[model samples]
Target chain A: MGMTIAEKILARASGKSKVEPGDYVVGKIDLAMVHDLTGPLTLNVLKEIGYDRPWDPRKIVIILDHQVPANSTVTASLHQQLREYANKYGTNFHDVGRQGVCHQILAESYVKPGMLVVGADSHTCTLGALGSFATGIGSTEMASVFLTGELWFRVPETIRFELKGTLKQGVSAKDIILYIIGKMGVDGALYCATEFTGEGVERLSIDSRLTICNMAIEMGGKTGIVNPDAKTLEYTKCDSCEILRSDKDAEYQRTIEVVLEDLVPQVSLPHSVDNVKPVSEVEGIEVDQVFIGSCTNGRLEDLEAAAKILHGRKVKEGTRLIVIPASPSVYIEAERRGYIKTFIEAGSVVCNPNCGPCLGGHMGILADGEVCVSTSNRNFIGRMGSPKSKVYLVSPETAAATAVEGKLTDPLKYVRS
Target chain B: MSAIKGKVWLFGDNIDTDVILPGKYLVLTDPNELAKHALEGLVQDFYKKISKGDIIVAGKNFGCGSSREHAPLALKYAGVGAVVAESFSRIFFRNSINIGLPAVISKGARGIIKENEHISIHLDEGYILRENGEKLPIERYPDFLLEILKDGGLLQNLKRKFARRGEV
Candidate 1:
């Protein structure tokens, strides 16, 4: 029987010729990641079990993306502990100022094709855009991996999403994913491996592909994978590497077809990531804050998109706009390109590269009875602030346009020179 | 594993990690401190209301978003004996097991179980005994997972394994 790319990757990691769905295999870890929020718990678990050192320090990656710069005394202490642990173990650590979002940092260089990766953050599946079978695990499970360098898995059945045609001007990979999640519902792909393929996927830039894969977890996907192609090779600067792809006759539990040419700006209403609608349906709803960064949409292209929209315009008088780059590299590049200046001139507060307001970790939290138009993933209830506050998830362009009007506005509704 | 008896708390679908334990409280490491915020997003003062050994019976897609293990740890520390749901998100399921929280999947758990009613779960026997004297079948844990549960979570299980091999 033919095997999918995920099955093939699992087979290689497990030292088997092939693996079928539901088959259990204990696989070696190529890379493991954890951030400030989850890292301390993992170390504590190891200490409780009396394992003082990681199996392979170099294989582990730690970062201070969440609550960076220390939101409180507790967070400062947690960051201190992570710094100590990273020093003791000699693991690859990206601390404050040097850190962006965890997944974004991995995408910058750490992630490579065909590797079996795991992280303590659910959004770790975002790394799968690099063609790795990466997924999220609990901190306790990560402790086991830290010591043994191995974790068991029940191979998930694969769900293939084949996109075709060109994306509309204002429509983005974020919209495409939001539309899929809306149709599939929250548990539509529970415990399943999702593969994004077809010509439309090939049309996506590496950053856009990352955006699509980052939201797979919103629909309960174990991981979202994209086949490594020429664009992927260029991004990773790989001269020679095995580019894994599914067989022509490989089986998929189900296949969803998306026609990208017909897609428009999509928005996820407050309280749920999957409660989506066309931006036109919910346009003009007032917003108090606008966020333009997170692991989902904090890449260079996303910043450029927002900057382009906000370049010559001013943010509405009553609204607040906050832009955060995903990583230091993105931060430098955006600054070099003057997007940062454009944002500041537009009356938006451009923060450092970290997860701000997305998880309500820090930087820009919503107040009671307020509404926010954000480009981040997951609009779950109270995700950004008070339980009474509401969040609407939109594309970067939409976020910027909404910021301009202090309401939910479609990007295409305005004309740019 | 012995049968666990607890009062029931009913919840709807998609009780995500943010609701289970909001991101603002992710900074806290102590389980007891984390417990104070359990379900605070969904139900105010829920932790104070919960008696030790209260089971949560939820609709489909419980623990749907975020891979924060704090969610399960908070539930465990908040005196939740087990979580009986129609289904659960993959990461949540794994986190629950790793934290020694029993997350049982019984299709009709929400419909058959009433809030504030008492129920008993026989994990090893693969059924939940409700106050109505009805036995509801649950999806049994696989052998490896069952072993982890028997040892009271992955931490203890790993300790036992390492001790046997003389690695720690």
Candidate 2:
């Protein structure tokens, strides 16, 4: 008779007393985000509706990434379209260099516990780390939200992930998610809400939690939810919020308990995120590129982790290492902490916040027969560049270590004692 | 109810939206231009090899990443009949249904069908006709989704709804 976190959030957003899995309800959207890659289509659809203005301009956030600095004339025009729409409607727009990535910027300011966020990008689930219910939507669906500020939800069934024990040193939240994805396979949590709870999750930093929730989509999850705790409250400075929780007797479609103490460094092999192997197994595999960034792992902590490994070491010859902070805030923090200078001195190309190379947009695209060990999610064939190239997914620690030895080397040996 | 027939084109698990339509072509607003590049990364000459009524049969987690409607739009414009999979991503499932492309969920379908094979689907009866003449039950959807498909998609259905509202 108790409700899960997702059920409670949907019920509250829809103004209903009670709702359950499989029930369709239209919920009020608190925040909607769009970036340069998808904003033009979203704006065109809204224009087709003949809307004099947005249903609520302040409710939306727009960022120009994917092709920052205008990779091409086409991408340049896209930024223009988004800018014109934002100016005409007086919506909140984060111009180039004003922000890094949309989700990172949104979490820094907009996201709140128990809010419902629908974004135009799949990584919108990254906001779920703040204990908000968020998911991706298409341009037409975004247009509907622009016109009515409402969208439907199916009150997804919840899958409880109870993390026990503590993560080993040199192992990170990225490894935790990669291990889960490997165990469950790609379709493990299809159409379900995978909620991370228990003591281990409580100890995870906001960046780690964001990294975990960002990949919930890889398992076909509707969204990943973590109840607002002390850390959440402290970070958001939100006192006396709704603070939703699943009842002790709440029903779950599946309950997976991961023991962090036993987990070692994990690496997702080429072509598939679910194709995972322990770092020991893939040791000595040489790589041509080393990338440490994405919405999944481009936070300040991620940069710090890489910088810690590359502080006084130079990258091996024939290896290309690129570092991108998740946001301008992260970049500024890295500068203050001297991680930027340390990286440049160590032979890594530290760029601004953008989705470059992750989706093959720009920056460090790979060539045929090349191999890259990356901190980003999704290692699908040709994800970074040529289909003949290979991508190995690892933690920032492993990426930095690999960049040094020019092979797949675990950072555990190189971590400061 | 009519039985839709098509030749099967097989694929494995997790055929994401990005592979269906790569990010490189996302800038092109034209659906026809997108169709030309459909599955071209994995399958060379994908658009040319696809028959008008060819159906795609894949393993679990089909259309997994990204919510771009351009994905299903590419397949629709490329003349794919329907996508039969073991499971599908939630957003991609809804996008495909709204776009009026039949996305049938038939468990163990990958083992049942092979490349370039023929299969038949009974939309009303919720079953698939294997080449060996065996019937496999499919997960049935709400009548409303079929109603939308019958009227040729959500866009057309919206037109009908607005027309009816004017009469009221």
Candidate 3:
């Protein structure tokens, strides 16, 4: 049988001629990462496994994100513990402020084509945008990889999404993903590898592609992969890595064709990423906070989209807005572009990226009964703060417009200009 | 590998890890501490109501968000004998086996079993015998995964490896 990109990647890593769905293979790891939230536990598991150091320290990257600058004494100690371990093992370490978000750091620097990347963070699948077979692993699994440098896989079946059409104004990769999720509930692609194909996918900028692939986890997918093109090579800086592609006659569990023009700016309402509605129906719902950040939508372009709307306008009275760039470099670029200044002048709090308020990790946490419109992914109950508080997931444009009106507002008006 | 019987608690589809164990309690570092909040987001007072040996029969994609092993650990400590969902998120499925918790899948279990209905499971046999004496699809452990559960968990499973390495 012809192979899909994911199957091809797995087959190569496992040193096999080919692997099919449901077939088990023990694959070698090219890279593994852990951040502050899971780093301490992952390293602890390595010790329990009786490993003095990682199998290959050079291949491991450790970053202190999640509760960075340490939220409490315990978290501070956690960061300190990770720092000591990284120093001892001589693994690549990006201590607080050196790196912004863990996944963002990998995207900007390390992730390359045709590699297998495993991370302790669920959003690790974000790296698949560059054509690598990246997915999340728990601390225990990560430790096993640390010891033997190989982890097993079930060789998930691939679901191809062939995107076609030109996106209308205000519709972006985020809208297309949300639209797909809405159609394919949370479990639509359970344990499946989703590959983006066709011209529309190739047309997406790296930032937008990151937004689409980052939320693959929300659909219960193992990973969302986009084939490598010139844009991918330009981003990863690799001369050539075998850009794996699905054979035309390759079998998939199913294939979805997404017509980009049919999509609109979308929102995921309270408590579920798949609980989506068009912005027209959700407009005017009062909001208490508006945040634009995370590994999902915290890139320079995301910040620029929000800045374009907030440039001369002050944030509405009694409403709050917070902007966070996904990486320190993105922060510098946004600053250079005056997006940061416009955000501050518009009365929004710009925070150093550390997954602020996205996982309820800290910074701008919601109080009881408050509702937030955010660009970050996931709106599970208490995902922001109080279980009673609510979150609506949107693109940066929608989040910025919501901040201005103190309610969920459509982004098309701002996008047209 | 043996037969185990329990009363079941029914849950619906897309029950994510956040709802199983909220992100707030992630720092607890103790499975028992995390257990108190299991399913609290979906079924308030879950810890208080649940008894040992109770089963969680859920719809598709149970335990889907965040690769937190705590989600399975929480359910295990909360006294769930096994989770017989329509399907499970892969991370949660792996974590359950690594932690010695049995996560079973049965396509017909959801519609057949009611909350508080008694059912028995056979891990090696791969079937859930319902109250009516009807056999339904249950989680069947493959040889490799059965090894993880047989050794009692990944920790024990790994400890044996280190011991064998020493002999080498």
Candidate 4:
């Protein structure tokens, strides 16, 4: 009869002693985030409703990421609107140079354990890696949250992913998630909370855990979470915060066993995130571009992993490589560590800290008939550009390897050798 | 809620937000302008083909990617009466309801409905009626969500709440 971590969090937030799945409750929000693309729309709703100010400005975060530096006049105007709103309301705002992907910014500083967080971007679920109950909401719903400082929820059932065994070399968190997504189609986890636990989770770094949780939405999860442990505490720099974990007898709708040793470098084929396969099965397919960035895989560790592969090699002449750090802090750290230099020397353009090309909004959009190997989540049609183009989702290791060969080459060859 | 009648536009599984409205168009706040690009990732000029009061009938997991309200707004502005899928991504379902667009879940929607077929949905009655008079059950909204829908959307509902509080 013990409640899962998700139930406990919702219970605490809703001021209830217990909450079961399918039970509707209105929960107080701890953090609410909005980004450039969705922020403008949310602000427009507030404008329409004649709501003058947010209920709690300090708890609200406004970040500019998706179309940073103003892709066009329209985007620039949108940025202006968000800035004015933030300045007027005294909300915590991250502007152009200070901004990163909203989720990355939240992970780097704001997210903490046992909190309820909501953001207007789908990848807001990324912060659930830190053990908070974070999920994505639409702009309109976010506007409501901004006004009332609360939102309604139907407590979702939990699906515990029992990860076992250590991941082999050249395979990583991305591979494990891709393997799971392939098994559980896109809707496999629809409306359910995904709790990642077990030995393999302990083996993963916070970055890797974030990568895993970042793709929860791709598999239709309401949120993906990892119980806070030593590594999570270290990453969040919270030595004394209360850590949330599922009880031993916590009720889960189902338990899925993900054996890490069985995983290889995995890739999601074009037009669908669940159309996954081992890199070897689709090897040697030509690629025109390689992108190693986005909220999903643009961390410093991702940069280092890709840089290690491209250290002494040039990108294939016909292939274009673009490396973007997820946040400014990550960018500075990567630069200080020489990963930026390695990427640049390897013929890849090291871009600014923003959501470059992941949303197909800027920087590295693909032309028609182009094929790209990217580390970002979601490979839906036209995700990176032309509907005729294709995207294969992989880890930073596989992306760099593919950049070197100008095709879908497995990373084991590069890393093992 | 009154009954809504619309022609069906059938689609397959996992029709993501990108196919509903690509990221490049996210900057546009105008729903009509967004409607111009609706489903263009799946079909060219799809909006032009949609008549007013048409409904989107699809297989599992329609609206599966992104938290863009523009997706549902585009469909609604393109004159889509409702979207009845086997299932929907969570955020998309919320976005649809928040924007006054109806997102229904009918397990047999795709099986019983054909493209361009006229169908009527009785939201209050919790069923879809095919032209052949086949009654398909649909998931009904909870009372609180129904209140939001009755007020036209979350925005209007908030407006009313603000007026009630004299906070507007």
Is candidate 2 or 3 superior in TM-score? 3
Query: Which residue pairs come into collision in candidate 3?
Result: none
The two-chain DockQ for each candidate, comma-separated, is 0.88, 0.46, 0.57, 0.92
lDDT of 3 by residue, A234-312 (tens): 9999896777777887899998999998888999998989999999996999888999999899998899888998989
lDDT of 4 by residue, A167-273 (tens): 89888889999999999999999999999999999889999999999999998999999998888888888877777788999999999998888889999998789
Which candidate comes out best when scored by lDDT?
4
RMSD of each: 1.1, 2.3, 1.6, 1.0
Q: Candidate 1, residues A84-135: lDDT per residue as tens digits?
A: 9999879999988788899999988688888899999999889889888999
| TM-score of chain A taken by itself, candidate 4 | 0.99
TM-score of 3: 0.97
lDDT, candidate 2, A343-390, per-residue tens: 999998988898778888789888899998989888887788788889
Ranking by DockQ: 4, 1, 3, 2
How high is each candidate's interface RMSD, in Å?
0.8, 3.1, 2.1, 0.6
Question: What digit string (tens of lDDT, one per residue) describes model 3 on residues B1-168?
Answer: 677789889998888888888877766666788788888787887878988888889988888889888788888888888888899987888888888888888886788788899989888888888889888976567798889888877867777887688821
Q: Spell out the clash pairs found in candidate 2.
A: none
Model 4 regions more than 4 Å off:
none
lDDT for residue B5 in candidate 1, whole number 0-100: 95
